[model samples]
Target: MAIFTENIGKVSVGKAVTWDRDAALLYALSIGAGRPDATEGIDYTTESSFGIQQKVFPTFAVVLGGSGGSMDHLGDFKLHQILHGGQSLVLHCELPPQGSVTPRSYMSAVYDQGKNAIIELTTELADPEGQLVATSVTSMVIRGETGYGPRPERAGSWAEPGSEPDAVIEQATSVDQALLYRLNGDRNPLHSDPVMASKAGFPRPVLHGLCTYGMAALALVRNSTLLAERGLGSINARFAAPVFPGQVLETRIWNTAAGALFQVLADGKIVLDRGVATAAAAVAQDAAELQDAAAN
Candidate 1:
């Protein structure tokens, strides 16, 4: 509570980062995209599968700002009790297949619930050319750290999910899900160590929250009428429960004027709730993006 109040607007500038096609392909595979020996969609999991056809997955944007790891000064707080609350991503432009980027991250807001505290963070991702690519908003909730400060009003992510859904997509996670995802450079011991899991009050190491989010996002885009090349306009969702590796996730979706509404159920529990996704054609976005002219 004291730490978050002290750093409300402080910005953290990350060192330069560079990634290539192989990085993109591995990221795709980590999220359960097509496989190397896939009869179709081979370009996603295999960098050398196709020359010009290979493309980067839009969800890969989540990893651009250091695999969504801790920001510069966020280490000041006790992170062992921290849980990823939710994430919302707004894409300003298509992410490059191979490029260098530096991030500007800041503490946005803090919401003090009765039993937990929600710390909000926003990071701007920019290419070496200074072109803004994406904006990621993440919320981390620290459990058992409540009552230290006055309760702050909840914002953006507190909405509840609908009881009924228009559609549902079920996806199964591999037993080695966390192992594969860690290769993307987010080797957080909390997601990989059983000892760490026991210390954290879980039965075993849990799957990355973003891993579940990525699978849900993939289902949202693939099932929509929008073209895959166009991708999504905005994506948001809440993380409610821990998902173990090899669990089956059922993502329920509802089409709406804004785009879509969704919630994910795992092991008979809602793991991701209050979700929203929007889509727009790439040509329209590309033209509007060219008009902005803002650089990092």
Candidate 2:
């Protein structure tokens, strides 16, 4: 508890991050974006389409700031016992197809949850002019590292709507989905090495939580023009269960006046729940930005 609290609010050195059109396209394809049966979102997958201009997916912010892996400032903990508990992101504006940003990250809080502990991290991504681009909040659960005293305040139970879903979309994940997603910066062996997965008590390598979250966002944006017009203003969800590769994910969404509530199910079990997404106002793309994206 002492170590965790002491590190809170201490900003780490900023890291310069850059991405190109290829990276944006790869991120889109990794999240099951471009398919023959896809109704929309070709702009995300193709760089030089006729009338469509390529755009970055809002969920791509997860990789823009990179994972908070430099945890030595905090006390040592078992790596295998850690898992992504939840993820949230708020985009300040539409991300260009290619751009650069400097990510400033810091430990936000630590909550003790009986046999586990939840470490919260906040990262701010900014452009070269120091304008905020996106803010990300990540919760990491460390098993068997509890008893430090502070317990997180319980959030209200998420009740499912009684009416039928507004939309239900099923997407298939490729067997190499995790492998492809790892190229985005997360190289955790738990998502790749079968031996490491077994040691962590899993039958096999599991898909990245961010990947699953991105897929959920993909389903929503592809299905609803209202949400995809500009891009997602914000989105958040809790990781309830592990999603193995090659499994089909069914995302059920319930439309609300503000935005929507959603859940992702794998084989009838909820893998992501307590979801919320807000749509951003549609913005026209600038030709200069498009040309810059193409050049770099």
Candidate 3:
């Protein structure tokens, strides 16, 4: 069976998740908040600053408010043929340091691209007060499952950014990075189960794409040169390759008329490509912010 385009608008509720500060801190560290003895972002990765202030990384919304629904309603396709294509996040406001959020999601679009089917899922995350926290849009490519779903009625709704990056941020991924990242919510065996990894045709477990996304966004925000201008408005990327633990990630970005274009690489390999990040639109900030961001 191919992707069930008929179910495009069907909606569902994901299991609610009660988030806390400890978990938030763990998430911060997993994304390279406080690593290599860097004190710049200790506020995110450590609790020492909790006495003064409680902060949450904006990107945490992806996991904290992640849609926990099953996509079985779509169609039957081999799991091995599924690939994470891209992810984008839109934040309405900063999330609280700790709170419970339930994600309501729907299948937005299904595209038949000759050799594979593309599934687009959108999830809205709301706090207990029903206030929107963030929205996550994820696309998955289903191989060998094609010619059944209808082409998108809208054209050019989803397009890749331009070539070349204007800014590049490099960070090292720890060998145990995946171990800590999985604790954020996704306990998927594919990221930790050696047997499952091998069966999936990998020598070992692979890092989660979301983790790479967090790193990419944070990299841009952490860049002194970039932070000197504005904050991150939205982040988007396509998972181009698998990133093994202990790899150095280089997030290359280009300032665009629309926002920012980007791509990620590991050991000279393109891992996440066709990236885009919209700026917060000229947020006032002095050069001092750059000094602070560079501490990390």
Top candidate when judged by TM-score against the true structure: 2
- Lowest-sum lDDT 10-residue window in model 2: 281-290
List candidate 1 segments past 4 Å from native. Answer: 35-37, 49-52, 67-77, 145-163, 227-229, 281-296
Model 3 alpha-carbon drift over 4 Å, by segment:
50-52, 148-164, 224-229, 281-296
Clashing pairs in 1: none
lDDT of each: 0.76, 0.83, 0.78
- Which residue pairs of candidate 3 clash? 166-253, 166-254
lDDT of 1 by residue, 1-296 (tens): 33446677788888877889889988888877762235555666665654646677777888877523454355455656677888988777776678888888888777776788777788889888888888898888877665446645533333445567667888888999999998987888878999998988889999999999988887787665552445687788889898999999888887765467788899889999888777755434544766786641
TM-score of each: 0.84, 0.87, 0.85
Candidate 2: count of backbone clashes, pairs at least 3 residues apart or interchain: 0
Per-residue C-alpha lDDT of model 3 across residues 10-101, encoded as one tens digit per residue: 88887777888898898889998886666776767766664556678878888864644677887787777888888888776777777888
